[model samples]
Target: GSRGSRGSRGSRGSRGSRGSRGSRGSRGSRRSVGHVGRVCQAGPTPSAKASSRASSRVDRGLSQ
Candidate 1:
């Protein structure tokens, strides 16, 4: 099946003519780091998560 990949840009790279999915839910290192409860670039680390969630909700056209 043709889909997204989850590996990195290594020297050898992936093989076998197959790859992993690239969905956000499948990313092991996924961390919502952005403007959540505060300014994404300037807010404290704590507020960043909140700001990011807020942003994602808005991005998805969902009411926050």
Candidate 2:
């Protein structure tokens, strides 16, 4: 006479838990600029040519 007393006690302990996590996105922006300038102000003058000619004459005399 005990046929329907053990059918409702095995259906309340089978539930699983769930986990939730979030992710964040980050970005970086950087820029750099460099500038270099150079100026030259030295050249050969007429005096340099005259000195070179005199040296050449002296060398010719010595060789003679």
Judged by lDDT, which candidate is best? 1
Model 2 lDDT tens row, 1-64: 2434333322211111001000100110011011111111233334445544555455445433
Question: Of the candidates shown, which would achieve the greatest TM-score relative to the real structure?
Answer: 2
CA lDDT of each prediction against the hidden true structure: 0.37, 0.27
Question: 1-64, model 1: which lDDT tens digit per residue?
Answer: 1233334223113321112222332342245433233355564665545654654444344311
lDDT, candidate 1, at 39: 51
Worst lDDT 10-window in candidate 1: 11-20
Can you give the TM-score per candidate against the true fold?
Answer: 0.29, 0.31
